[model samples]
Target: MRPVGLALIALAALIPLFWFAPLAASRDPVALFSQYLGTAALIVMGINQFLATRVPGLELVFGPLDRIYVLHKWLGIIAMVGLGLHDIIDADMDGLRGGPLADAAEDIGEVSLYGLLILVLASVITFIPYHLWKWSHRLIGVFFFMGAFHYFFIEKPFANADPLGLYVSAFCILGLVSYVWMSVLRPLAPRGHAYKVASVRHINGLTEVLLEPRGRGLKHVAGQFAFLSVMGGGLTEEHPFTLSAAPRDDRSLRFTIKDLGDYTSRLYRELKVGMEATVSGPYGNFSMPSGRDPQVWIAAGVGITPFLAFAQTLKHRESGPIKLYYCVRERGDIPYVADLQHLAEETGKLELMIVNSLEGVRLTPERIVEDLKGDLRNAHVFFCGPAPLRKTLKNSLVLKGLRASRFHFEEFQMRTGIGLGRLAVWLWDRGIYAIEKRRAEKTQPAE
Candidate 1:
């Protein structure tokens, strides 16, 4: 189906629960609707998170389904708002005051208050932009677990009162269990080995940290990433950093991270040698296929880090037939240029092309296409950069009659949750559904 068709279908499925107005006004509609919507939102969030980490083919769905993902995030915010509204505007507030909710709130007292506080904290933290979200998102997970416990014990009375609420509660419990299992419990399972940072090297305005895994070493392929978290620090903050070192190096693993923002900028200043860090994986499919065909790697700025891993892998194997086009704003912006140059010198099969767009030397798609006219037909192009640059290159490749399968890329941004509360607020603010009306022309029916 088309992207719009899929979105319309999803909207159709979700809208009816809200649009049905009053389903027996004697019942508390707000509470009832909020329970359903919030549960569904959590389920969807869990599914999306799981798919994002585990599924490779999700890119096909997510690529065209960006609008659905946006809607999902807004819907999550809306669900949170809906829950808040349900609490505030509950018709049974008087009954609840003297009953289960109130008694639970009073008996547990400070623990209940802390759980509510944590929920509020999680809501506030999620509102930040994607980049900052990475550093702060782990705390949100803490809030999630706290909230789950609160819901399990304190709020069980309300959920048990109604059949619909019972079902919602059950589903929510399962969803929370699944989320925690996939994200936290599974990753922390004993692997019987550990890695320590041997040396942290600062190169080309980026930090390249070498990791030495004790015992059986980490088995990884080129162009994959590992989720690394420093010991003593909470597991919630484990960030995925691409491996810049060759996979063949069993003795150690190296990660080159640019000082882009929060986590990275502090790596050199705060992280120390001999610090034991846990590495979770070597995930991603941005490497060249095994067959013997020419390959081109297009990298912009810090995107060169992954290519370093690929180059290192090729170097260790003494394999060639791969060309790299490294583009940057200036000559100084290029990371590991000398190393890449040395690799090119050592391996005659490797070709290096550096394009400086800022030095009045514009690197247009047309120019790149012309440069690789012969090789472009067979080579699979792997590009990593900012969205706009990727789009330009993608469009250029499409115009040149290149297949979509020939291109590969990765996004560094995190997908934030969308709730129904945010959607309502957005619609209210923007009047998004205001469709243009066309005047009906007078028509005569044929006899």
Candidate 2:
């Protein structure tokens, strides 16, 4: 997917250079560079919007949800660099540089550029509050429209009767159309049914939220997740959590959320029974395989959420031989093991292994290879853990003769806000987390 994504970006980047090279070379140096900058910026923005659509066809090529987001982040960074260069090189404020026609349009373009810089920055800044970041994220379309207007109206080569103009404008139009459909039309889009909290179970700093649909419910498979919004919780931001149980006819949903940050830590106290919420989605393709291939499943910490869904799913299927290694800091950190044990008994094809790192029984790639032994020959490795751990195993086990395609992993962490930016933003985010955590502590609901 990375190579494929790079190839697509290269195509978008090259269209303008190839199409307008003759004209640009014949123009002023400043003008040439400015046109290059503007074209590159808009092209990459178009690529970003295409990825945002989440079309199943495109996702099939993208492979994983996180990979698409990673591409989105890189495209945003590249577009920002282009916009910055355009602004720096084309800094004539008055109508003196461009014609009287472009003077006002150029200013509008500058305003859009500045707004975009802030929106891209907020995604990585983290401490700005998720809701604020998301709301600002929606402003991308407004600035994108402004940029498109600037491109079309500024009397540049793109405005002329060049294929370059039509080509770039096509992408801009497609991107804006996708944006309107996704961002503007999503709220009005009929997806899944509305849900309300039926119960909340507190367990070892994790909250098991059980929701029942108000009308019809979501049809979700095991190992898939949905975007959850708990209304009346003082925070209306939607967060993704895996469905902890298999699909049942009653349309019930379960999400075991670990208290990882300020937002999650506050969920238990703020959310009440019967609180209205929305569950819109059953996204992800990280379920069991169709073939009769032997499988190796790995789970770490809270990453086991998806695998729990898989386990419940296994109950109804003709289960195959499975080896699952659940790694945790300690035994107490492992949630829902009893359920897994019962699943093992019921399925008779599932084997559970617990690895407690604090007890010095660390889970390593070599250990996995040794344990699987002959089974490792053709077994498909499915990992639902931290990215670093998965990458490490991929490198180590691939050296030990693991097939790259057979090894699959899903990133449970949200990558929407991750991007290339100042290292200080991370520190600032941590500080914001500390302050918010303290505030959450101080404002704990009275028992």
Best by lDDT: 2
Question: For all the candidates, what are their Cα RMSDs to the real structure?
Answer: 9.7, 9.4
Candidate 1, residues 288-339: lDDT per residue as tens digits? 6776666778888888878887876665564437768888876554678889
lDDT of each: 0.60, 0.80
Name model 1 segments beyond 4 Å from true. Answer: 1-39, 46-170, 178-193, 231-237, 249-251, 315-321, 331-334, 374-377, 414-447
Q: What lDDT is reached at residue 105 by model 2?
A: 82
Clashing pairs in 2: none
lDDT of 2 at 192: 55
For model 2, the stretches where C-alpha displacement exceeds 4 angstroms are 1-10, 28-34, 53-58, 87-99, 125-129, 158-162, 177-185, 188-191, 331-333, 416-447
lDDT of 2 by residue, 1-447 (tens): 557767777877887777666764556657676778888899889878878877657756665666677678768988999999887786332222455657678778889899889888887676677657777888998899898888877856445457888888887897798899888786677655689999988877779999998998899888888888887867466777888888878999999888887678789678778898888677777788876677889998888888888888776786568889998886554688999999989988789999888888978888888877756668788898877788898888888878888898876666544544456688899999999999999999989
CA displacement after TM-score superposition, residue 432 of candidate 2 (Å): 28
